[model samples]
Target chain A: MTEATFDACIQAILKGDKQGLRDIYDAYLDYIYRIVYGVVGSREDAEDITSEFFIKLWQQADRYKAGSGHKAYLATIARNMAIDHTRKYKKEVLESFTQESDDDVVIEPVSSDNTEAEVIEDIAIKEAIGKLNPKEQQIINMKILSEMTFQEISDILKCPMGTVTWRYREAIKKLRRYGYYEES
Target chain B: MKNLEKEYKDQIDREVPDLWSRIEAGVDAYEAEKKAAGTAPSSTPVTETPTNITPIRKKNVISIITRITAVAACVLILAATVKVTQRTKSESAAPAADAAMSEMPQNTNEPENIQHAEEASEATEAPDYISPITEAEADAEPSNSYKPIAGADSDKNASPSLSPSESAVIKDPVTFDDARDDLLPQLEALGFKLIKDFVFEDSVDKRSLSDDVISDDIDIRVASFTDSKTSDKYYVVYTVNDDGAADILIVRKADNTGDILYTNPSYKNK
Candidate 1:
């Protein structure tokens, strides 16, 4: 995941090197999977988007500017793929059932992470994350899993930094209130 | 809250499946597609979703269109086959019917389905216009020289319901021709020479024929005779000629079933 390695990967991709893509996939799989899983809340959907994300990386090697952050570029694509998947899935559901605008429906997700599902792997914290709204889970996954900054989160979410931080703080408070942690 | 965040980060992350095989295959396919598309002679910048051209969906659309085109081709072929079959039947049917007609003189198998032809021939052969030749007359005449002038253009709306005025619109050419031709020889057998054959428009008020008729256009031909020895007025006839179809046949429909709202004797028009 070093800048030099990332640049080499991009160069190899431009030359149609499958190994280069594999190297990138190996590094970012968990990070990207968490981003997709956090948004879509389904392991199956996460794998599809994650696999597709690496292929897009290989295909769009030319698009990545050398100096800009490589992980950020990847995170953006992952978030977009997840968002696009959600929109499409919602649209299909709407079409199959009845004609109603999907924008009106709030996205309340039970997060993919689970504390009770296992003792290790931050089970309590992960379970608490699940109780948070879908966007909150997405932001927390980006923050904790990918180390994306509040400003970077704001940029991707297309909102103010303050709003991103407020959601992050609010998400933490909601997790605590769910009784995994005592009231501060 | 800080403890929770610390604990969340401290815990080992969950591992996703080692998708090396699937992802590598996908990436290889993607690179192969890009290489192939790059070689294509076009300049639109490619999209990034790695599957901008959805393979299954594109196939489905083409499949539906192919099915539609196949159906259209089938319809066209079936229509052509039907048309050819009908033509074969018509061409073959006409000759066979003519043969059957030649077999019987007075006894045409006038099927009830052919209402117009039966009514036209039978109803119009009233005692006033014709009298059956006697046995002595028949003995002198050749048996076949007097066949009913084969069927008139029966499709002409020769309705039995036609007003006498409308009925007159159709000149009895077949009846007149058959009778004249048959009788001329019989009269000659007795002793008479045909003096002159003249064709003139029947001066009967042509307007009564129909609004579509012009008096000048109606040709009424007649043959006059005198006795060879006595030179007495023997016979004359209104002519019936089939050298030309009765009138201009106007086939306006694709069915090739031509139509005429009304017709009268005229120089046969196509």
Candidate 2:
């Protein structure tokens, strides 16, 4: 959706219009779901968190300042909700998941009732992503799924922009090595 | 690659069930919850109290501490000023009093009259001390009544984590008032007169500091000080970024260059 339309939807939501939220949900459900799914790696958890994210947006619509990048705003909230969910329920897995930080963004292959060929291809991509450490997987998810800038990702991750960029480059390199990406 | 990104997004679209219905239901449930709790969600902004209480508590603690410190400082300054004024008044009045006594008839037998005169003078001068303390109390009262950044209270009520602009008020390592309080004296001592000091509530579009137009999406505090001798101006730009890092720079008006007076170690290490 265009920034103008997104902003209008936020304004509408602020004014207590459900249609505005519906418009936003219709526009960005896949976008938010993809980011959440990428972080949590469980379809059920992703669904739960994605729903909570929208509800959160509905509740906190007034907090959104007009003219700020709504996509980044959505991505930030979606990603945070997903991470928070992981931290809440899957603490043990997270404790051993990474020594880097508490943001244990584990991207396992999600089992879905898709055609075998599609499932296989999806698994290949998931496996490729899963090969990297949790941090790299997170960088890949945000960069690819949400198309967040390294700086935006850095802000979200509380890491330096230089480190974000370097990690993104490393993740891309690893993906290339896994034969998923062709060098441009 | 774009293909990988597209595939990943598309796969999620195909795999993850649309939770819009559940989300819609969740919003309905939230409204109902608010209604049951006796809050009309439509009229009042619904605050998630569980997450909000901590930060508001923290803000209250900080605000109270700041108010107490301001009142204490004001009291100390007033006390010092009163002490100096009293000393000066006694020193000036000594010679005049001696001359007046010499011009008067000897009153050694009427020491009670002298005591009465001194008591009257004390009674008259007592109000001056009382008035300044009252003025000092008046001055300290406004510290508790700062104009909060626009929507800042609501923002604080809404979320534990602050938005970029909102965090400018909350998460800055050193706030504008604190910086001004500390730096103004140092700047004055360095022979600089404060020209203008203000905060950019929104992201500055293009603030020309030392010929450089800064358009970063960070809340900035700009304090301009003029050199007392040269009348040359220096701009102190204190930026509080969204990531909770802050920086302060001093830029010379003539040179069009700035020196980093302070950088948050988090920012510098990053």
**Candidate number achieving the greatest lDDT relative to the actual structure:** 2
Off by over 4 Å in 1: A91-123, A131-170, A177-184, B1-12, B32-270
Model 2, range A1-184, lDDT digits (tens) per residue? 8889988888777666788999998888888888887667677888888888989999988888878888888988887787778778876545542344424333334344322223223246667777887777877776776566777666656666776677777676666544455223
Model 1 chain A lDDT-worst window of ten: A93-102
Candidate 2: lDDT of B67? 100
TM-score of the first chain alone, every candidate: 0.62, 0.64
CAPRI-style docking class of model 1 based on DockQ = incorrect
Query: Given candidate 2, what's the lDDT at residue B195?
Result: 38
lDDT (tens digit, per residue) of candidate 2 on B194-222: 33433333342224441233223234556
List per-candidate RMSD values in Å. Answer: 18.8, 33.2
TM-score of each: 0.37, 0.40
Please write out the lDDT profile of model 1 over residues B1-270, one tens digit for every residue: 236645554442454777677777876675566556643211112543445446545767888999999999999999999978864654343332222222221222332212232223243222211112222222343222111223533432232233444334433546445545544532322112332342223553333222233232333343334433343332232223243212221101111221221121222121
